[model samples]
Target: MREVRATDLPHIREIYNYYVANSTVTFDEDAMTLAEWRDKFYYLNKQGMPFIVAVSPAGQILGYALVSPWKQKKAFRFTVENSIYLGAASTGKGLGRELLGELIKRSKAAGLKEIIAVIADQGADASIKLHRDFGFDEIGRMGKVGFKFERWLGTILLQKSLK
Candidate 1:
């Protein structure tokens, strides 16, 4: 895992947009703009948070993992939410495991007390399994909490205690 750079935004956007447009893994409705993503890059980098990319030796971005504040409250400061995405052709290569493991390590090192995952009901077994493998436990299930693609989507909350 390596720190993502500004130049890596294109591939990151591509990877994320794929999930947004094609999968229920993320709740995002549209592809983020380059400018919007730049702000993200700056925020995570400046905050010393992990914005990790899994790259091939040849430098192609294969997957990425990251964490953000679980909530915008001071009481929630030690908790963070995690996200991971692999390139379309990069699935089943163990990159998600490597990336998520690194994310857990980095988040704990940053003084986080917990890692939370908000997973969509559909297309989330792999992600749920990945988080479970990393020790995240299911906490709640909200039924039909989201509407996308002409259907209601459920949300599963999973958390791993970092303390």
Candidate 2:
């Protein structure tokens, strides 16, 4: 894994777009342009957030993990919301564990005291378990909070304290 570079956005976007188009991993119903995606990452990087990509030995991006503000208010400054995405072919390979672990390490280094993961109720059992294995506790489950694909999807909120 390594810090995300500007050149890495295309590959990263590709991985994300696959899920956006075909999976319930995210609630995003539409795909974003490369420029918009680049700007999004730029803002996070500018704010000193860590956006990392896991690359194969041949340098292909296999997955990515990032940390962003949990909330806009200053009182929430010491906590962050995390996101991790991998290529469809990359799941179940233990890459998610390594990627999340790295995000936690970087979050702690950034002086973050809390990490929040909001996982979808559908198709995220593995993710919830992954967070649990890494010491995050499920604080709550929001019932039918989001609608996608003609269905209501709930969210599980998990928290991990770096302190």
Candidate 3:
């Protein structure tokens, strides 16, 4: 695992677009263009957030994870929200766990004191389990807060302390 590079954007976009087109994991109604994808990272980079990707022995990106400000205000600087995406071919092989492990490690190293996860209520059991397995606890749930895939979707909030 390592920090994401400019070249990794294409693979990251590919993995993200797959879900945008076929899943409700992301609430984005449409796929982002290459330029938009580039823009997505600009703010995070400016905020000194960590965006990392896991690679295979041959160097193919297996998955990616990132942290963003839980809130942009100064008072929220101690916390971050995380997002993880795995290539279609990468799931079920512990790639997500490895990527997330790296993300959590980096977050702590960066002095972040808390990590929050916002997971889709449906089709995210594994994600919930992953967070819980790493010591996050379910803090709350927002029912039907997001509309996606022609239906209202809920979000589950989980939190973990870094210190």
**lDDT (Cα, tens digit) per residue for candidate 2, span 1-163:** 8999989999988999888888777989888789987898889987788889999999999999999999999999888999999998899999999999999999888888999999999998899999999999989999998888899999999999998
Cα-lDDT of candidate 2: 0.91
Per-residue lDDT tens digits for candidate 3, residues 1-163, read: 9988888899899999998998988888888787887887887788888999998899998889999999979999989999999999999988888988989999999989999999999999999999999999999999999998779999999999999
Q: For candidate 1, what's the RMSD?
A: 0.9
Per-residue lDDT of candidate 1, residues 20-119 (tens digit): 8988788889999999999988987776678899999999999898998888888987888888999999999899999998888888888888888999
The models' CA-based lDDT, in order, is 0.90, 0.91, 0.91
Q: Could you tally the backbone clashes for each prediction?
A: 0, 0, 0
Q: Quick one: ranking by TM-score, best first?
A: 2, 1, 3
Q: Which stretches of candidate 2 lie over 4 Å from their true place?
A: none
Off by over 4 Å in 1: none
In model 1, the clashing pairs are none
- Relative to the unseen true structure, what is the C-alpha lDDT of residue 3 in candidate 2, on a scale of 0 to 100? 94
Question: Can you give the TM-score per candidate against the true fold?
Answer: 0.97, 0.97, 0.96
Which clashing pairs does model 2 show?
none
Report the error of model 1 at residue 161, Å. 1.0
Model 2: lowest-lDDT 10 consecutive positions? 16-25
Error of 1 at 152 (Å): 0.5
